[model samples]
Target: MPATDVVSWLATAYLSGMNDELLGDIINDVQHQGDTSEAMYAVAPHLLALSQKSSGKMALLMLIHAGLISASSQSQIAVPCPADLATEFQATNNLGRSMVLAQLAHNHEFDDFKYLIAALAGFSGHGRFGRLIEGFDLYQDQFHHALLDTPIDDER
Candidate 1:
């Protein structure tokens, strides 16, 4: 599918309010088996524009997805992003950073605030921290156990 079509669908879904199934479909269309497609880069500007409009769940999801696509393009197994796309992607990342920073400045009460933080980390060029945030759920049990097992120092 063309990037414009994908962006149109995403915009419609965002306007209509997205559910998990729709998010899954969006992810599938943009990234395949953890690999980002050219269309992902192509639609990034649109996604960033939409994300800038709100700090809601759908907007955060779009930012996070764009961040993940940026990360994937840099992975060793992935193809090098085309220079034109890379330039556009970098611009999107800059705008995303500004958006996330503004969101972080506000008192966060939303359930998906952590995802916004992750997007901030990613847009700020800290891919490792971004991945940590994004994958925290996968290791939450182990992390909790580790924290519980750690010895505490009483001396202050």
Candidate 2:
């Protein structure tokens, strides 16, 4: 991975820990999605790629949603949490396969990896839900913000 991508991942991890209190609402929303495999799946890369093309509010909203989902599912630490995992989608479609990609994108601790992989498994079993999330265009500014927040790494 490029130093920049590593930096981006680091920033998200840092801010999430620091902003934990402020992000309760968003966290819950993401957890809700994680609770259901039918909801968010393993569509990280595609969502990340799609986010780049997003134009405005839709992009921001989706991006935030996507990030939360990534963290929620990927946060292997929360594996003990009960979730309502749905069936996986068939890989017959291109998008469905992409959602599976999200599952493979997590760079979290063991606990996070467990949660994410489980969520991805559930979503993949759902037929096409994972694919649908993959097709969404969420504008994620993590890379930009991560790069900009380089000065604050010491705070972590």
Candidate 3:
């Protein structure tokens, strides 16, 4: 199956109430099969949508965090963060930690961003976004301080 088709299937399966472990297995199977470069771009808009919703944004955050923490085989793709959305994401209260996570993930320069985006859409209505957001809120200050401590290259 094509990567896009697999992504669509995964999204449909998850939204149709598929089990989490099963979804992960499916993702693994797909990743094992071949390259997913096209799928990466295909899923960016979906991630953008998730990032906009209060209900879905936490899932996006979690997926991004997870991808950042663990190494994934899929190639990295930068999902577009529109100017307005970028501003809103920046303005989000207590989201500094999440932003730090995103920056770290981006800097890692590996792992497909689309996978996280798909996972976010797949986890829609899962009710765990609340806990995820709460965790971020609880740790935002520490992450902000950590970010401040790290020196950024002005040249980049």
Candidate 4:
């Protein structure tokens, strides 16, 4: 499918309240085999637009996916992002950063505030940290147990 078509379908499906499983298809179309396709750059601007005009889970997910795609483009094994696409992606990324900051500033309650912070980290060029934050929930119990078992030293 053409990148534009993919964007259109994604928007329609998202607005129509598609399940995340189906939406994962759109994400997979742009990112597969541990790398992003050129289509990701093309779809990024549209994702940014969606994020801007939407709210809640869908918007945050769009921003995080786009930021992850941009970050993956920097990996040594991945194709180098085109200069033009990089410029456009950076503009979108900056806008996403601003949106996240605005949300944080409002002190709004979020069901997944950690994901929002993760998206912010990715937009700020700390993709690894962002990923770690995103994965924290999966390991929350283990982390808590480890912390409880560890002895703290009061003396330097």
Colliding pairs, model 1: none
Q: Model 3, poorest ten-residue lDDT window?
A: 66-75
TM-score of 1: 0.68
Candidate 4: segments with Cα more than 4 A from true spot: 1-22, 105-111, 138-140, 144-156
TM-score of predicted structure 2: 0.27
lDDT of each: 0.66, 0.37, 0.37, 0.66
Q: What digit string (tens of lDDT, one per residue) describes model 3 on residues 7-104?
A: 66547644653344544544454333333333333333333333443233344453443232222212243334335444443232224234334544
**TM-scores for all predictions:** 0.68, 0.27, 0.28, 0.68
Clashing pairs in 3: none
Summarize candidate 2's per-residue lDDT along 1-156 as a digit string, tens digits.
Answer: 123433343345345431333233333433444453322343333333444454343333334445445434434343432233322212212342354355457435443443334335333443233323333321332212222433322324
Model 4: residue 75 alpha-carbon error in angstroms: 2.5
After best superposition, candidate 3 residue 54: deviation in angstroms?
A: 7.2
lDDT of 1 by residue, 1-156 (tens): 476656767777668755557666767887867666777776667677766665566677777677776666555566666677878888877888887777677637443566676677767777656656655332422332222454334344
